[model samples]
Target: MYSKKVVIRYTATNVDQPIICQLVKKHDLDFNILKAQILPRREGVIVVELSGSKENFDKGIRFLKEKGLTVEPVSKNVSQNNDKCVHCGACTAFCPTDALYLERQSMKVLFDAEKCNGCELCVLACPPRAMEVNIF
Candidate 1:
């Protein structure tokens, strides 16, 4: 079996809740929240990582776009600046995929794109807008 991974990002305002829920239900797709920083601020980005059959993946993308979600291909390049970071853990805490982590000794933030769902929660939480999503 072959599978493809797609990431979707969107603000709370753009989200179509019912459509998202319905797609999840109908496709039996695995949805993982990569970030949720915008929840508290009433505006945030959601990153969902979906892996399934190619056909289902395509359908899922269409469904998300129709629902008003910004869907895009995940990119490896991430805009992160550790110098400006304060190690507040906001990004780590908000990461739904456990992709961001803090080193035990240095307390530095790290990112794993493979595990990232491309949700922009970290982007929304960063005070300096350090985290950037590269949609291809």
Candidate 2:
């Protein structure tokens, strides 16, 4: 199966729509919602991992764009800047996938890029701004 992680932005007009459901039902796609913060009549965002046939995946993404939603890949890479990281463990607290964690013995922070879902929570929580997202 083809799979990719994506970030979808919703404006107030489409915030209440069952867009993800449509992706599944109409485009034969499967998705895992990694993170979401949506409210009625307001801008919202969702990070999701979608999997399906390549053609179906393309159709599903096109459908989202047709609905006036902004869709983009989560990131090409998510990395930690060791030069800037203090290893305070702040980013670890916000990492739902355990991609960032504290190494108790060394008192250092470690990042595992494979486990990250690209939700961007670590980027927001890191006080030192060590966690970085490279979209390209």
Candidate 3:
């Protein structure tokens, strides 16, 4: 099966739609939602790993775009600049994978690259802009 991690951005009007559900029912795809934040009348974002035949995967992505959703490959890399990090732990709360965590005794934040799914939430939550997403 073909599989890839992707990020989907939803506009206010499309935030409530069951678009991902249709990917499974209509396109015969399997998906694992890594992270999501959906709210009524507000923009939404979801990070998911979709699996299916190559043709079906292409079709599913096309379907998303047609529905006015923006779909892009999840960043290939997420990194933290230790020099810039104050270790405030803001990113730990938003990280779905626990890739960012605090060393309680030292109160220092640490990152485990292997645990990261590249959801980009940490990048958004980091107060010092220490978290960085690298598409390349």
Candidate 4:
């Protein structure tokens, strides 16, 4: 099985559609909603961790595009600027994936890149602007 982290953005017109549901029922993909801002009758975004076979994953993404949803892959270029970071643990509080964590022994901020889904919440939560995301 393969897994992908992706961001889906849709306008108010598409808000009520069962686009994500179709991925599971029709394409046999499993999706976990990581973060969502599905405001009623407003443009919103959702971050999901989708897991399935390669073919099912591709087909599900294609279906989303066909339904006029803007599907973008989670950028793999999320990083923390260690030099600028103070290790205050602020970002860790908002990290849904536990990508940012404080070491138990040292209390230092540690970033695990592989676990990061690039939801970008840490970027907003960081006080010193230490967490950064670059599309790649």
TM-score, prediction 3:
0.60
For each candidate in turn, the TM-score is 0.47, 0.63, 0.60, 0.62
The per-candidate count of clashes, in order, stands at 3, 0, 0, 0
Instruction: List lDDT for all candidates, in order.
Output: 0.66, 0.86, 0.87, 0.87
> Model 4: runs farther than 4 Å from truth?
76-129, 133-136
Candidate 2's TM-score:
0.63
Scored by lDDT, model 2 comes in at 0.86
Report the C-alpha lDDT of model 2 over 3-92, residue by residue, as the tens digit.
988989999999999888988999888889877888789988888899999999999999999999999877545889999999888887
> After best superposition, candidate 1 residue 9: deviation in angstroms?
3.2
| Segments of candidate 1 deviating more than 4 angstroms | 1-7, 16-18, 40-42, 76-136
Writing each residue's lDDT as its tens digit, candidate 1 over 24-125 gives: 787767676554434542444555566667677778788878777766555454556766767677898898888889889887788777787555678898
Q: After superposition, how far is residue 103 of candidate 2 from its true place, in Å?
A: 25
Q: Answer with 1 or 4, whichever has the higher lDDT.
A: 4
Q: Cα lDDT of model 1 overall? A: 0.66
Compose the digit string of candidate 3's lDDT tens values, residues 22-112: 8789899999987787878899888889999999999999999999999987754578898999998899899988989998998899998
Question: Candidate 3 — what's its lDDT?
Answer: 0.87
